[model samples]
Target: MQTRTNTFIAITSLFIALGCNQHKESVEPKNGGATEKTIEPTNKVVLSSDIVWQKLNPARGDQSPQAGTIWGNRNGKVATGFLAKFTDGFSSPPHIHNVTYRAVVLKGTIHNDDPKAEHMWMTPGSFWTQPQGEAHITSAKGDENIAYVEIDHGPYLVKPTDKAFDNGERPINIDASNVVWLNYEKSEWLAKDSKAEISFLWKSHTDDALQGVFVKLPKRFNGKLHSTGNIFHAVVVQGGLDYTLPQTNEIKALDIGSYFTSSDRALHSIANTSDKETILYIRTNGSLNIDNK
Candidate 1:
């Protein structure tokens, strides 16, 4: 375990730090002829409803599934996170992508394995990885099939099976129930008194490798993902919560598929005030300290 003890440090940051805060506000000035103006920082947020869908394979045209990007650009050479939606009973012919990627099933069920492998359905919360140039077939079941896919860097492209070549990394398909977790008592981030848990999914191969992790919040749980990293990405993979930034109380729905990125030290307050648990999938190059409340 290469866990970085975040007494003060952790997760992986994204490929780029993207944010724009051009919000403007007007207010009455006591002794001014015109109202005073103020600018508000609209946190870097990308919602599913706002995502621009594109064909996963432009060449395949309508024959391909849809991809909705959350952060970065899959067509560009940079780390990216996006959603893949497949129609029910959808299955792809044998194919390979140019880059290795990590994926998490968010809705319905997905089966991603070798072309000749038997179907192994993975339900919501399941995690899987596809090595670069690995030949595989992706199949989906149920009416609403969606999964969160991420890449370390891209120009993500689908290629014919003959182009497949080993990158030395093997594929892993872990059912949700098979996930091993570290409870609050064992983790350094969560409050020892809280019932939250965390699970690490992957870590990049670079010296300052980014980490992909899942943090599960108990019902009504409130906390902050206090971290010093300048580049980070947090996506709601399960359930929902209110996300607020430092010096700002304007909380917004951090529901599934709604994500926010940051390029500076972040003190993001999150709360799962609902009755159900909420899970956040965070990627960063540094560690985090949870301010349990």
Candidate 2:
């Protein structure tokens, strides 16, 4: 009878031990089987200090910019950028982002359109915006490789390029004869920097619409500050920026290929803290919801 009792107690204890181990595993973070665990910020992912933005190559004939974007997604943050290469034609099929896009052609000419605009030619230093839901078509022209910065609400590409548009659609055409010149030019301040050429892109009438400014703030420019949709995000495609928040007075220095967001309800701006010209692509919208602040 004593042996039976002992066996029952042992079984019960064994079950208890197993249960405790299972609970521990469920609560523990999967940190590559290491005992050390990293605690993420309350509402953010802090990229490593050494994490630099690097140019990504798209497939041939797709917008595979030779010198292009180094970017990040700031979880509902207000911004994103793509440094497109002119050497390789942008190859992705027509697609749309969760938000609208503002673009500035830094060098070479970019062809863009939908069934509506047909082939609209965008030249170097030209800035423009496209609304969400608008089908985008693209190709690069001219000998010089083109580079540009784009700004938009991120987590942008929601669908695969292959499924985004109907097949058999033709590329847009540019009427070299009727190219409407907005007569827009870079900011005088930016011109003096030599490395930077700053110019305002199109502005939106609605609160949630996409808006942006093109800047070639190479070593000449450090940073500029502005409020974007609801959240503030920054990108360092070429050099770097010391991003600061007006509300919190917090500063984050991000390098090339690095990005930072100032959080919702925070007033944020980017500054060129380094000697190298800090090329930038920036966009600001009121809120992603379009109706809400």
Top-scoring candidate (TM-score): 1
Worst 10 residues of 1 by lDDT: 15-24
Q: Tell me model 2's lDDT, rounded to 2 decimals.
A: 0.42
lDDT winner: 1
Task: Give the distance in Å from residue 171's predicted Cα in candidate 2 to where it truly belongs.
Answer: 16
With candidate 2 superimposed using the best TM-score fit, by how many Å does residue 289's alpha carbon deviate from the native?
30
**TM-score of every model?**
0.82, 0.40
Candidate 1 per-residue C-alpha lDDT over 66-100 given as tens digits, one digit per residue, 9 for 90 to 100: 99989889999998999998888889998889998
Number of clashing residue pairs, candidate 1: 12
Per-residue accuracy of model 2 over 145-252 as CA lDDT, tens digit each:
444445445654434344443333222222222222211122222212234343333344554244443344444333333232344444444566665544455777
Q: What's model 1's TM-score?
A: 0.82
